[model samples]
Target chain A: MERRSKITPILLLAPAILIFVFIFVAPFIYLIFQSFWHYETSYVSKQVFTLENYIKLFSDPYYWRIYWRTFRLSVISTLITMILAYPISRMISRMPPGKKGLVTTLIALPMIGGGMIQAMGWMTMMMPYGAINGILLSLGIIKEKMTFLGTETGILIGLVQSFIPLMSLPLIASLGAIDPTLEDASKSLGASPLRTFFEIILPLSIPGAVSGMVLTFMANLTMYVTPSILGQGKIQVFGSFVYQQAISVGNWPFSSAFSLFFLLIMGVTAFLSSWITKSIQKSIYKGNEA
Target chain B: MKKFSMFLLLFVLLCVASTVIASPAEAADCNWDEATCEILDGADFGGRTMVVGVWGGTIEEIYRKYIIPEIEAHNGKVEMLLGGTSDRVAKVYAERENPTMDIAYTNMFESAKGIKEGVFEVPSADAVPAYADLYDVAKIDAYGMSFAALGIAYKPEAFEGEPDWPDLWKPEYKGKIAMSTFPGSDSEGFLTIAGYLAGGDDTTPDLAFPKLAELKPIPLFFANLDELFMMMDKGDVVAAAVFDSYTRTYIEQGANVKFSYPKTPGAIVTMDTLCIVNNAPNRDMAIAWAQMSLSPIVQEAFAREIYFGPTNSKLVLDEEAASKVIYGEEQANSLIRMSTYMTDHRDEIVERFNREIAED
Candidate 1:
């Protein structure tokens, strides 16, 4: 029976493990290996191991500019998404059960159409003669049309809009799990609403907030379509740059190296974020003990 | 159970009767010798299916309307994989060993790369009878189907007269002209034009970049033909470096656009080639399809319908149709062909373009 139980779990997990190995792990390993190869042309790559691809990336100031731009835009977009998501999620968490579901669905409606559809929607509204410009013109906000296409500002707006749901769902889950009586207890003890929120609610929601930020930041970091469509090939963010190298220029080795470096940056950022979250929670617990 | 079986019998009988009635009508209309038809009468394909990769939109529509029926008449099936040249080339490379496509339509540069990588079968007069009818330029790496001359396409209302390539540098047109992305055929043409204007030929290609940057036109970079047309129609851009074939289509569709082949050096020519995959599954059908595509009838139709300069030397168009395309030997000779230069310096050129012109 013990052997059967062990075998049963392994069997049940076999399909998932096989899928992960083939789809994710194998490709990831190949990508790393490919980064070490030398690119010859579009359809040709030599297998002789070399670090030329990485050297090329590090040597060029153009690549550095692109990487720094990608980082700055991702950070700004994630921060804005988190700031907007928190209050909305908190409001929904405190709502009546029926109303909570309705509000939650409304929060997630933009995401239901997927990223490409949302990007296209924004494209329709953000074009020079689009609805946004028309509205602004009617209201006499400006005499001339504003250039939204091929600008970093336009890409930032797209990133924040698309990633807001990713930030909100985790926050809503964590906030909803909090016991209402704890807030009531603090209130009954003469703590102000703002004070109770700072002392109790905020600290308890750190994990969810951290998770949301990490996911949104990671997503925005590798964003391709939104930036490419909104940026119109001028912005040249990290994701689109990789695409230009891999697909357009047919420099697979260079693209692979670029991707691996981007992976390292994302890993470090995620690690630092989690470490900071842990430190904050430790301090909050120590304060309570005191 | 009896009623269900009777209904099934009736449905099967109906389907058989419909096909039986449809086959003869289709077969009778098949003109075997016609260049536009897909199949010869009495030739049995044994139900073989040929997959063709071609550009979508009007091109694919024309093929479906005129070509597929004849193939179907001879018991052959055709499946179309519609996408850009790069998309199709990437697929062919990824599946090189056992390619999913039988025939792929690609630009000259990509076709050259494919030939170098041993991804395509070299065409010969024996394999494709229409090979005899192609010009020397069209017979290089693959069977060239059509060519387009690149020039300035502008709004008729925006300018008093036809603008030359140097007019792109004028201060008034800054931030108003759109160009295709670097590493694309259109941009490569623009680079060559810039090089010519700078008094540098293919040998001194580097001089073109500085000249291009001097224009300082913060142009919208179009990723596809559809986007270029959309921006032009919406008046988001006033002018662009575009192909004659595409601009002609837009003008016919009443986009208020006019294309001018610059008088000083004339337009640059880009060719689209059709090649069979190295290990294509349906080799015979693939060869036949390639031959049919280059047939005089099809070539003439393409020239008339889409303003594509037909690769078949025998194809003769009317004066009006010939005016829109690079038709004769004189026009062909005058047009700049940059296939060799582009193939050699494509990587450096794209990298520099991204760094300087596109980013700036």
Candidate 2:
């Protein structure tokens, strides 16, 4: 009976283990190996072992600048998404019974159809003298045409629009999970609506905010098609850089190294966010215990 | 009950296995060759199958109107393996060890790179009899194949007159001009154009840097032809460097785009060539297609419909089509043939461009 039980678990676990090894672990190991090798020019060119790729990456200011720019863009994009998502999420969470469905449908609308169509719509709307430009000009808000699609501002706009959904879902869940009586009690205790938000709601929603931030941040970091298309190759994000290295240069080894490097950065950010969220939770609960 | 389910599964498996085993044998049954075409007057492949990897879009119509009909006449089918240039190249490269294509088309630089990497075999000219009539320019055998040039394109409405290479550097056209991010010779051509105008000697791009830097804050740097076309269509850009085939099509489509040969010898020329994969699936079919592609009739058809200049000099086309094409020895000699220097200095020039020109 004991042996049969042990075998059952192994059988069930086999598929998961196989998938993990095949999809994630194998590629990662290959990436690490390739990073240390260079392409040899001989027939079936031998991969020469070298630390030069890493050394070159370390020495180049150009690559470092690209990395810094990518980090700044990711953080800025995530922050904007969070700021926009927070209120909408709270409002939706507070929506009376049946209206919840409508709010969700509205939020989920962008995700329902293909991304390409959504991207195309944004392209037409965001171009110089495009719909946004025309409307702004007619409203006498701006005189000169705004260069949106090719600029960092345009990239931010696209990133924020695409990632609002990722942020909103978690925030909505966290906000929904909050007991409304806490807010009610704060307001009842002579606190203003704003004060209640700061005192009760904001502190309670730390977990979701952290989750949303991490999700949006990672999405922004690994972003590819949208930025490449909208930026018109003007903007060089990390994902696009990896793509160029792998395909254009056929430097698979360098691309692999770069991908691992990006993954590490993303992992650190995720860990930091999680740690901060946990610390905030501990402190808030500790005060409750007192 | 368990046994019944297991038997049912086995039965289904057997059916799938049989189909998989049989499909390829069926596909290969149809003979694709010149002999088949000749004996049948080249009309026998109507119901047979032939697959080619191509850059899709409006360019697909070239196949739809011309190549398909010819293939269909011979009882043949042509499947399009479509994507961007990089995507298609990666796919073909991955399948280099065991190619899935009978014929493949890619840009000239890509084809050259592929040849150097041993992703493709040097084409057999004997198989392709029409290869004899190709322009001397096409004969430049870096990648073991011929290439077509993408002469300069401009907005006729925007320019008061036909502006040559130097006119791009003129104060009037400053900031109004757009150029694609040319990784190699294309950039060299632009730099050279500015250099020659500035009266600098030596093919080194150092002399051209200052003049190019003068056109500060180049509003856009397009990644692809489609993006460039979109910019031109909206009048966001005026005169820009582009391929003749692409510009010609746009002009025909009622766009305000016009193309001209920049008078300063050779302004810039891009070559799009043909190649056979290193490990093609149907070797017999591939060699046959390469030969067939070089036919004067096919070359003329490629020119008239696709607007790509035929390598075959004897291939006559309509006057309008012929006028746009730059073929022949005199034109070839006049043009500055791109070299390894252009490729090697790419990073430095682009870096300078980004720092000096883009920052503004």
Candidate 3:
């Protein structure tokens, strides 16, 4: 009976498992194989195995510079998103259920739109004489025109705008789970409002904040449209490099290698983030126990 | 006296009637009816769909106005697949065996590469009657559909006079000059011109980047025409490297930009090409499409509407249209064309361009 039950569950998930293998696993395996193969031309790639793609990539400092840029930008976006999303998440979490649902929907509205359109919107707004500058200039905020297109600040603005909701969702979950009376109890012990937050709310919300940060960080790291449009090709990031190699230069082997390497980096980042979140939560509980 | 006046009036009426009674095809010198267009007339397509891939905007508009109607008149449906050159080229190559795209519009760069790889059909007059009438430059790996020269698109207010190649290097214009992104016809042509400025040719690409680096702190690396034009309007970009056809089109549309031919070497030749994918779905329809594309009437529309130089040697534009487009064999031949040398060293050149020009 026990064996039959286990078999039935596997049978129920068989189609989904097959689909995952075909769409994700099978192509991924082929991509790995192709990464090692020698590139003859844009269309024709040789089957023989070679580590030339990896070796060539590692040899160039340009590729590493691009990787560092992507990493650096993503880290900055994540930190900013965390700071901005916390209060909004806390406010939303403490709201009445009816208003909460409505506000949350409105907050997540940008997520429903495609990245291309969003980036294009930002591109228009950040032009040398675009709306942002136009407004500022008319208001006598600046004497000279400020350039936003082809700058890191422009790309950062776009990343943070898109990611705040992602950060807020996770934060709302963890912050909501904290008991209201815990804050009151802390306050009853002669704790200041800020002290109550640090001793009670902030520590409890770390798990959610960490989850949000990781999500935002991963998103910003892999972002293509925002940087490609805002950076205007001046700022070289991993996404731009991959696109230029695969599409423009048509060096698929090298591009495949570049992508796989970044995939490894992404995996390590997620793992570290997860480990840090767990460790912080454990230490907080240990302090409580003591 | 009354009878004489009546006879004169009758004679004048007869002359007017004869002029009005003449065949519509006979009325125009450049007719596309049976007399001049026997190749496309009364063609039976059996209601099948012919898929054509071309860049959207004015180019696709020209095809729709001139070509699509001719096909539809003979029971053929043309589905327009509009996108960038790379995406279309990728499709034609990936589906070479059984291509859904009957006619794919490509640039000179990828068309040559596709033809070399046997992914595209070779150009021949046997399939398209008008092919025989194309200029020498148009007789290549595929049909050279249109030609334009790479030149400077400048704002008049920012320059002292009509600007040339050397004028771009003036100290005042340092950070305001915009360049097209690398690995494209515009950028490659610019590189070749830089090489020329450096006392070498396309054969010596190493000399090009160093000379180009002098124009650093470039404000914009424009791939989109609207973006470049907007910057020019805003007075942020004074001059930009662009093709004549686009500049002319924008000028007509009231954009604050002017097209100038450089004096040092000359404007670089950029050609838009058309190719039939190997084993394309609609072979007969594809042939018909090519014939219509190269016809004099269609070529005239392209010159008038979109400022592309007609590839057909038979196309003689009127004085006004001729002034707007590249007309006459001498002018066509005069446009400087860089060799396959630039395309051959694409990856290296793009890398160098990225390191030097694209980066701050």
Q: What is the C-alpha lDDT of each candidate?
A: 0.84, 0.68, 0.85
- Ranking of models by TM-score: 1, 3, 2
Runs in model 3 deviating more than 4 A are A1-8, A135-143, A177-190, B1-50, B69-79, B96-100
Per-residue lDDT tens digits for candidate 3, residues B95-194, read 7777899989888878888888888888887877777888888887769888898999999998877899988888998888998876678878888888
Question: Model 3 lDDT vs. the true structure?
Answer: 0.85
Segments in model 1 whose C-alpha atoms lie over 4 Å from true places:
B1-27, B32-50, B69-79, B224-236, B314-316, B328-330
Residue pairs with backbone overlap in model 1: none
- Which candidate leads in DockQ? 1
Taking all chains together, the TM-score of candidate 2 against the true structure is: 0.83
Which lDDT tens digits does candidate 3 get at residues A158-270? 88998988999889889989999998899899999998887789998998898899889998999988898999989988888888877777777888999999999999989
lDDT of 1 by residue, A1-290 (tens): 99999899999999999999999999999999999999887746899999999999999988889999999999999999999999988999999999998988898899888888988888778878878888999999989988787888889888999998899999999999999999999999999999999898998887889889999999999999999888887889998888877777777888999999989988998899889889989999889779
lDDT string for model 1 (B269-296, tens) is 8889998999999887887787778887
Q: Judging by TM-score, tell me the better candidate of 1 and 2.
A: 1
Q: How much is A107 displaced in model 1, in angstroms?
A: 3.3
1 versus 3: better DockQ goes to: 1
My TM-score estimates for the predictions, one after another, are 0.90, 0.83, 0.89
